[model samples]
Target chain A: MDNQTKIHIKNLNLHIGKQQILKDINVQIPKNKITVILGPSGCGKTTLLKSLNRLTDIYPDIKVEGSIEIDGQDILKVKKRDVTDIRKKMGLLSQRPYPLPMSIYKNITYGLKISGRRRKRFLNKRVEHYLKQASLWDEVKDRLKDPASALSIGQQQRLCLARGLAVDPEIILADEPTSALDPVSSQAIEEKFVELKERYTIVMVTHVLRQARRIADHVVFMYLGEVVEQGSAEEVFGNPKEERTKAYLRGAFN
Target chain B: MKRFFKINRKIRNTFHKRWMLLSLIVVIAMPIVLGVGLYLKSAMLLEQTSLIKLLFSKEWKPMQGLFGLWPFIVSSLWVTILALLIAGPICLLAAIYMTQYTKKYFLRMMHPVIDILAGIPSVVYGVWGVIFVVPLVSNHLAPFFNTQSSGYSILTGAIVLAVMIIPFILNILIEVFRNIPDQLTEASLSLGATHWETVKHVLVRKAFPGIVSAFGLGISRAFGETIAVLMVVGNVTQIPKGIFQPGYPLPALIANNYGEMLSIPLYDSALMLSALVLFVVVLLFNFASRMAIIKLERHT
Candidate 1:
């Protein structure tokens, strides 16, 4: 119920058929800060991130119980017709970059065009603005008309980030966004996130502890579908309260 | 014992390599052999008449030795194109719905149904056309459009041909839609685009080349279909001016006349030329489609 909480999860549980993926979870994600969900593989980090924007609805046999509130609205209860509006409030970055099968300029304009933005002059300006925001404007400004698939993997990931940002979302959810990139590209994304946290509520999921330590303002450590600890970066990383968290930070089992 | 076994294994390996090499050579030579044989058999007609005249003229008297093939060529083109026009949209939409909208279990259930449809004999399809499609066209569709015609017409042949090729085209399209990675769909959806929008902008765009090749293969299959089409398409030698009119296609011409061709002087040669034409047209179509797919792949 705190005013600073951008997203509040209450008793949320998810099941795929008979297998439970996420246990009853309660957490408060603050506004204008980087909240990193840190966990090892198969620990439901990506699943928790996906549930924020209702991306899990695409999967069959997925039963979600309880509420996921964003801006005081329970997104889980929104009707099918209104889900797109709910999704429009969040930008998501996946593990791999999947550029639209289109030219680079069109990829950025796709989100704008679908939202009924038809003015060519407006679209052209926004494309450049978002590319600049992602720090990729100079590298790709000349070849905007080329197909997006022609770009290298790092450039393509940047293009995807630019495309997501063009939607003008209030929150950014990234699921291991740098796992597929080289170290240089990974650092670029990490730096961009640190800068972007000033304006947007960023929720990132990553198994890389080094990444979690670099930019996370709020850290939520999870294990076996349960949140083991949640607090400020200093409290969770510097002053360990839970034994599991202590063991995990000390180069224990992944 | 170990030395003897090693020597035996070396001999077996050589035999295996030579056997594979011979099989590869035979596979490579099959098409070449077919092309050469068809050319030689059709050489007599080509030597007697100019290629342009034989292809462009429409005369068809056996006693007078006139064998123009323009009408048959036109009929074949009409039937194949009409069949594609009928089946193309239906198959594409069906494939998208099956892969994108339906559940996995539903798609799994449809696999065997499509296979059975494809496996049914062509003669069985011909009989079905004679019984069902012919009446539907002449008694219902033609009358509704204020036209008069016999049950057997090009329209009937196209209807039958479209049904026959549906399973083939649908199978390829299903695979094309399914092969597109889920990541693209997720990216589009995450941008606040609806499911329909994501499918239109991303999935269809990515699958464009595969869809083109699928339809191209369908066109080739419909072009050479003999039994079902031959039964429904009225064997008139004149060019068909409308879908309701009877016409003769190249495959039907060869099938219907090969029995009596030996008695006529140049009839046998003309029939062989008809077969040759079918072979070359299908070959050209397949080659063109492969080129289109490659160009699309490079662009994307």
Candidate 2:
């Protein structure tokens, strides 16, 4: 595997029920590095993330024309099996934690069970490893069998992170993981993101500029479904190349 | 000057106390009134029949001092359960389609379709069943069920009841499914789960209490339905050994026999006893519905 162009998104266009949403987007995601997609609400950052895994394909009446490639294999043109295989290499954590109506242990392991392959020893080790990685091992280890919903919102979000990590995906897509959390909780999640960049390429969509600035290794600024600019986090924040990025950072249009 | 503060303080103090007292009275009074009403009504129903003696005699003729209700009770329950068997899957499929797979236009059209089916009179349904559904079943469903009779049996009655009450179950179940958050569905689908899998694991799992309540309500609705059932079910007072067997439900018996009974205490007592059973069944149904709704509320 050439260590370049881990994920390539080219000429991406999206429409929801005949209204054009995202247009003419092109981006390259580098391997083993965080690429935070920063934008205002309804600016299509989340939509771009969802397209990588073809998650939007599930929505009926959704029109999409895009070339998203992973490791030089165009995922959209490839067979659904190949696409699902690619999806396994990419994990997603939504804005809010969605713990299944099951035990915490099972919630973390649901994806595996649904795929119809289970390994007890591996699952146990993976569960503990990911939980510890998400910094939720101590708070929930004693009550692994308890309902995941019993945990507080912050803990649930962390638990979801642990769940996503359990799949051992190299690329993690987090859609505003801390948006619904308290300040302290948000800080904790941000800290986790900073530490996670060593092992995983994390693409986080955050409306909060401070959060993006704090943890983003590379930043991709998007507005109205187009990437305005993308570069090293320091460069993007300190000297934004595009006017839209400047306007967004300065709290003008969302 | 202090009067204002004192009055405000009194209001604050009494808000919780008064609220609790009001709710408590309302809650406690309803059951009390219900219990007294049931007690009076049941006593009145039981007075006509020698309910105590009838239990031991095992004979089912009120004219001959034998007032057994075992067959009627059995038939009533048997019809309801049979009707549920016939209708449950149809309503469940309808619910799944309505909730998961349906588009906005289809959903918009659903109300009218359900409304038309629901608004059709029981007698009209009876007529329809006799004219349309019965022949269709006799030609179609009966072949599969394989009954000796060409038409008019427990199977026919249950199918009629099923057709009549399916919309009711669907309406209730749709509300239950609707109450479940769309976020749950989105969350599951985003995880690469299929439509049925999402429905089974997320949608149905989330809406279990509501579905159960629908079934209970459906059972209650089917239990008391008289006209349609009486029209189709061959009203013989047999054990209803099978769906194809001719049998009489409690309601049908009441509707048919209520007219013939005159100036006879036994006749009236039998009627009252059946009414008492119906009342108890209804009360239990309501209690079950309340419990399910409470459970659903907690689930949300």
Best by TM-score: 1
How do the residues B103-179 of candidate 2 rate in per-residue lDDT, one tens digit apiece? 65677789789989899999988998799866776677768766566577777788889888899998988888877
- lDDT at B187 for candidate 1? 88
Model 2, residue A231: displacement in angstroms? 2.4
Which candidate leads in lDDT? 1
Task: Quote the lDDT for A87 in model 1.
Answer: 88
Question: What is each candidate's DockQ, to 2 decimals?
Answer: 0.77, 0.35
Highest DockQ model number: 1
* Chain A accuracy as TM-score for every candidate: 0.98, 0.94
Q: Which segments of candidate 1 are over 4 A away from where they belong?
A: B1-4
Compute the DockQ of candidate 1.
0.77
Error of 2 at B122 (Å): 2.3
